[model samples]
Target: MTTTRICVDPVTRIEGHLRIDCDIRDGQVVDAWSSGQMWRGIETILTGRDPRDAWLYTQRICGVCTTVHAIASVRAVEDALALEIPLNAQLIRNLIVAAHGIHDHLVHFYHLSALDWVDVVSALKADPMATERLAQGLSDWPNNNARYFAEVQSRVGKFVASGQLGIFAHGYWGHAAMRLPPEANLMAVAHYLEAMDYQRKSNQITAILGGKTPHIQNLAVGGVANAINPDEQSALNMERLAYLKTLMDELQGFVRRVYLPDVIVIAALYADWLPYGAGVMNYLSVPDFPRDTKGTDFGMPGGYIPAADLTQFHAVKHFGDPYFEQNVKESIKHSWYKGDWTRSPYDGETVPEYTDFQQDAAYSWVKSPSFADEPAQVGPLANVLAGVASGHAGTIGYLNTALERIGAITGSPVPMAALHSSLGRHLARCVRTQVLYDMMVENYQALVANIAAGDTTSFNPPTFPKGEQMGYGFHEAPRGVLSHWVVIENGKIKNYQAVVPSTWNAGPRNQNDARGPYEASLIGNPILEEERPLEVLRTVHSFDPCLACAIHLHDNARQTIVRVNAF
Candidate 1:
């Protein structure tokens, strides 16, 4: 069989530059390489910085994933000092986390990855009334009317006529792999435009709580900087809380009525894609939304499920669980780093050595991260599966509801095992979003009740000891499990390493020379057209790749760089 090597240089619509190389044999990807075409030296930048101020710098690692990194940084410092923050702080932080997650998932589906499955040009051929009928049958969202869809269609038509698709440009329109009908395409496009508004509303909650969106201003070592006083307008008072509830209500409605339903409909329509993209099934996620100050109890459950087997689940109990710390290691063998050894994050080093795109050797800048000496996939799918394995009621309830809806659409029962595929990742993300909505409401109420009880404290000052201490903090971020490891020496950061979600999923071969999740998932994925690999984008986009978190840009010359392309 003749194999064709295809190179998708700098996969667009993602956070950072990522080059995906695949070998196509008989229209199927037989082998693949996932490479992060950048380097992130944030770990080395914090060499001798103050531990308390570490969160501020770390949050800048990625503009999109700022809040998660901020939260993880502070938690790491707190864990190292064994500090417990106030309950009010915990609740406030939870709200920020949930809101950020909701906003991220919304934008990812509608704005980023939706174009892979939805054909914008085909929507131009759709009947507005037919699209309205299809949308109304799925959900009672108020905008599901012919007039509204017609207006949306007109707006899109203008963009097309102007020859400036803008965000909709560069799409593989009319591709053979695009399976949706014209009406369905129009409906998805309509929802895609509406999603922009709701995602902003979700971010408002984060801005209100965290003082900003990209790089939140409220996080501290011990707790959040948000003061509480119902009578004071400047503090986190009743009026702000009420406003937040209103935003939450709007977001929850969209998630239930629009976002969740949209994903389910798309998944059902693309049911044939359900069997592909389930690779490196060793799942790993960490417990988040802490209910207590010591970081022991959580509203959401997270653990490890090895080899796609739910029965072999192992929960990482607390803040500094030896189970997690002892097993986490990063191998630089296939990465563009100085070392060739697999070392724990505590002893991790990030010295760059650029050896451009060596397929048989070092290729990616992302270090291969492993758990228990194996590549474990991390993301919403991992979070949902871990929750289901741990018997969490909220996760189970939402999972069953989504499965039933998909099954109803397909005229058959969707088994739990089916969730181990591409469409399953999309479904699992929706399930996680629904559960997160409930968590947001619960945390909001808890914050109100606590404040009503006259407990308004949100911060607890930290006192670092005069010695070296190492600690790790893990958060089940929007992408997956994001952890920050810190070695603090006399109040200064000795060493810092962030094993981000993308690092786990988008990495190169591990120490055992095993393909990472992204590379492995691409195997067996069909490439309908050699020149235009729309099928390739469908599976890769399912993971919501954020290479910015996995790698970073380092250009010391400060020169303008441009690459012209002829498509």
Candidate 2:
């Protein structure tokens, strides 16, 4: 067998740069490696800076999850100081997070990820009336109808007219995998544009509470810097909620009408995809959505899952909480970290020691993160399963409805174990949306009632009781589990490390040669061509690779060479 290599550096349309290398043997990829080419210095940058400014700086780590990083960073400081933010502060934080989750999902699915499955050019051949039938039959509001469809047609016409198909010039309509008849693609195409506009509105809610986005301000260590009075709380206005409800309504309908069916249509055409990308069964979810306990409001507590029994079918085998350090450890065996060995997150360090990208040697800068010493997977699918298995009411109902919808389309059940691919990623976002929306209502009511309950203030930065201690603050963000650990001495940051979702999913193989979530998922895909490795793209994109947080997509602050066997 002759081997051919395909390398696409700077994976386009994502937030950061990536290098996807595929080893093709007989027209199929026998092995694949994903390299994120940047080094994030957020932690290094915050070392001597005011610990108070940590949240403000850390939020810049990723444009997509800025709100999540800010919240996690501040909560880390608050945990270290043993500070209890006021009820109002918790509610405000909850709102910002939920808004971020909802808006981020809408935008990511429609704008960045949908093109993988939905062919825009093929949509031109779709019968508008059939698309209407799909839209009208759903319980939600109609998707972008005739007028909106016309607008998209004109817009796409302008793009093609401009001779700037750019990346889209090579239409995939003739590909065997392209099976969605025109109208369904048209509906999806229209909503992709509509989702963008609606997502911006939801993001505005975060800005009103936290400041601006791509990164927000005032999401400080001891709760919000901006105070919310009755007027301000009420300023959340029914209009904003209405916008979310409408947009989400359309999204759910489109998922049921356009996306889900599209998945089935494509899957039927490419039945081989069913088994190629299943990675480790280990899964994790950080509890999000604000829940009240003992007069304390906690954003959903973080949690995890392990491969214990297959009969139970995606059941939670193990549970973990805020003390995430016990559950997470990183192995530098195949990464650039020149450490003694795999170290606990609390005791972790990131010093990139570059050797070479040899299979038997160092391949990625991403350290291998394991859960309870296993390669735990994190992402949308994990989020949905954990939410449902944990018995969150909103999540259970959301998942049940999705099962019924997919069942109707497939004429059979989509077993829980299948939550590991293009289908799982999309479904997880819907489940997360439902979960955060429910929390938004619950949290909004709490803030309103707190004021009426005669506690006019929701923030009280208690005088820090002195002690040498450390703590972990963890919660689920839209992408997956997010956590931060901090050790403080003399009211300054002594030791700090963060295990963001991207790191968990994009990490390298461990000493045992166990693959990180994305790498493992990429290993078994069909390559078709050495020059165009679309299958590997499908597998890696299914994980929604976030290179900024992983910081391995070519934006090194400064490169230095250190001699180490691991590097």
C-alpha lDDT values of all predictions:
0.91, 0.66
User: TM-score, each model?
Assistant: 0.98, 0.87
Shift in Å, residue 548, candidate 2: 0.4
Q: What tens-digit string does per-residue lDDT give for candidate 1 at 135-168?
A: 9999999998999889888988999999999889
Candidate 1 colliding pairs = 39-552
lDDT, candidate 1, equals 0.91
> Residue-wise lDDT of candidate 2 within 1-567, one digit each (tens)?
788777878776577767777777876667667676776656666554556777777777887878888888877777666676766677777888887887877767776666766777777677676776755554344553666666666777677778786545654444545566776677777777766666776777787777677788766666677554444545443444445455445444443454434444444433445566767668877655545411233444335666723233332221123335575787888776576488776677767677777667787777778877888888777777666555657667867776666666666666655556655666667666766766776776776667667665555563444555576666677778777767666666666777888888887777688877776777667665455555666677777778887773222445654446874
In model 1, the worst 10-residue window by lDDT is 553-562
| Candidate 2 Cα outliers beyond 4 Å, as residue runs | 138-140, 166-174, 231-272, 293-302, 308-323, 462-467, 552-567
Top candidate (lDDT): 1
